[model samples]
Target: MFLKRITIQNFRGIQEMELNLAQPSGNRKQTLIIGENGTGKTNLLRAVALVMGGSDALAELLNTPDDWISFGAPFCQLSATLLTQAGEERSIQLTINRGDTLKGIVLANQDQLAEIDAALAHATQNYFVVGYGSLRRLNRSTGFSRGGETIFRQARATNVATLFNQEALLNPLNTWAMEVDYRTNGKGLDIIRQSLNDFLPAVKFHSIDKEKGHLIFLYGSTQVPLHLLSDGYQNMIGWLGDLLYRISSAFNDYQSPLKAHGLLLIDEIDLHLHPKWQRKVLDYIRHKLPNLQLIATTHSPLLAQQAQEHELYALKRTSRGKIALEAFRGTPDRLLLHQLLLSPIFDLETDESLAVEELKKQYESLKRRKDPPQGKLHYLATQIEQLPQNQRSNMNYGNDQLDLLREIKSELKARRDS
Candidate 1:
């Protein structure tokens, strides 16, 4: 259920990139891949999805074999080592030839392959739910073209989107109360309904039928269709639902003991989320899904800052057309970086002494030049001199002026640190 490591070769823009997952510790199970846009973040996710289920979900995101190879290179390869819940280890390696033919190889003992096959079969069922933008696009198109029937059909066809769609399909609270009765012991259907209601207060699903026609989702209270929630929301719900479904399936099998290891890969986890929400969302995932192994990519410095050192992979492109992934070290204070980046334009803090000395020098030089503009300079000097001791000692000016000073200070600090 968990991915121990992944080695990607000639996959899309990545000539070769290997990443290792840290073991789950305490209540947190998470790994964060940090990189700028177009630096193979999404490609990494595509590689995982492709290996996990061999689905077409990553088709649009991947380059064709011809395109994936370096300017004059050949073929593409992706491989990963995974540990399943049954304490069995497995490996998958996929290679694409120049003709676009894929050669897939799985390495494991018979029992491990059986487990991996089963898990992969289940994974394929819900793979479509992995991308939120795709759902939103489907919803918008369905709204105009098919009256939402297409959306519902597509969602159900890909089991991944069904939970969100199902959540949306439930009646409003008041309506459900009128139609459904609570059981005496609050078990059975009542428990299911209550749990659904509690876990999904903001979610609603609407369907309309024309006489004998099939039901279809028409509208939702949330801005997008249930399928079209923000990527963070979609990823959270989809991942949780997938885990729950797998757990339920495992329980039903009876023969397999409950396995604690699970692997999760997320790309651009900060997509369509604000900084504050990003932290909260990630924290929620880590806390709520403690036993699962998580590997995710992000461009948000905030996310990088929040992640543990062992859980971070910094991806950089080498001149030879290969992606080099290195474990991130040192304390990355994203907020401080943000402040320093903004300081050049706005002064978050000021040195009044330096300001006064500079002003005095300028004023004296202006007076020595016998400039008639001494009137304005004199007025500025008098204003500076009249400032209170505390204010004059160290002043924090407005953003516009403070920014320039901050940049200067940052450059000096960088030099000193180096």
Candidate 2:
């Protein structure tokens, strides 16, 4: 099952917003949402979770009774268009009546009724969404819960763990040990190992140090404990391991291969990740779980640059203050960081650094004075040349600075020739 599109209204920071997220004609399974804070990126993810995870999940996500509605708005609505595993269209919608209970409906084509019903019965397994937030804890004790800190994680962890081992619901450490150990079934470990290697070529999964009760990831024969790794390493392991565990739980056999497909929603997906890793994470995810659909939010332009144009979305605020979606309008691969920073996603008016900004202002201020001393002109040209090329190329005045500098240098040489 995959979410083809989603519509959200009267939900925190979103008055009315609808996004058509169906993957374009391609084998790609990734979609990205880029927005500044408070643009409702997380809220958009929650709307999908509410539909798939049901009312209980929504209740836990909302705080106040009125939190479901936009400030001063009477009601809230969440809806989505879905594609069932059988290639049939379906929909799940929920409406919150202010100060009252929430109402919802799940609809399917008459021919797809039975199939959709069965899909709903195993909704968590069919559309498993791992909504990872930005602030993941590092150096977590080996006994950390599989679900992490969110209410959604806690509940899903319990539900899935119940299906595999009732005892694991109480002792999550058992789940952790099984996840790191290849001896259980050694079925999907190679796939996961390959994924990690693809993202971090030098790092390899060595083995579980059974006596020490820690998972060992190796760097060229050097043992690295999960807890002792850098924040970036631990964060990556934390989410990836949890996802593998959930996928494993779907089959009720740790050694058995994953037989389910689902969605993954990560906020600030680049958190604590180095730029190099940021560029590879999305591709690694696609390679590892080709069937899984991912909708993630990121501040890293490096991640955005790798996405296809159609797969990238920017959450924009209308003049009225409601949120809207805009498809990125540039060639993703050709777009550099400076270009991306100035895109609506980043909303930067000037991609120039402070030093460049100061230099440009000085140059402009000098130019407005009508050809300051030749020494000054030469000095400004030298300073501009010394600035980073990326910053220089993104100057606000476009090629005007270059032309002015060239003209000044020519004039200085002409005086000497005369």
Q: Residue 138, candidate 1: how far off, in angstroms?
A: 6.9
Would you list the C-alpha lDDT of every candidate in the order shown? 0.47, 0.64
lDDT of 2 by residue, 1-418 (tens): 7878888888876878787876457433788888878888777776666555544444444435466578888877777777866778777677666776322222222222334345546654655665666654422345545453333344543332222221232223224455645545645455445545565556877665556666677887798876676666766665666666656766454543333477777777888888888888887877666778888888788999888757888888888877888888776767767777776667776666888778867876887786577678668867776665543454444566557556656755676798
Candidate achieving the largest TM-score: 2
Model 2 pairs whose backbones collide: none
* CA RMSD per model (angstroms): 11.0, 5.6
lDDT of 1 at 68: 53
Flag regions of model 2 displaced more than 4 Å. 23-28, 101-124, 143-154, 157-195, 256-259, 334-351, 369-382, 385-397, 407-418
The digit string of per-residue lDDT tens for model 1 on 1-418 reads 5666777887767877787663445222577777655677766765665555433322323324356554445767767776655656777666555556222222222232343455546753322113211122222222112222333333222322221232212112222221122222222234223223323324433432223222222234433344445555444443333333333333332122123345555556665566666665566556544555666777676676676546667677667846777765544443354442223222224444677757645655564675448466546556544555332222334555445344434544565598
Tell how far residue 307 is off in model 2, in angstroms: 0.4
Query: Quick one: best lDDT, which candidate?
Result: 2
TM-score of each: 0.53, 0.80
Error of model 1, residue 102, in angstroms: 5.8
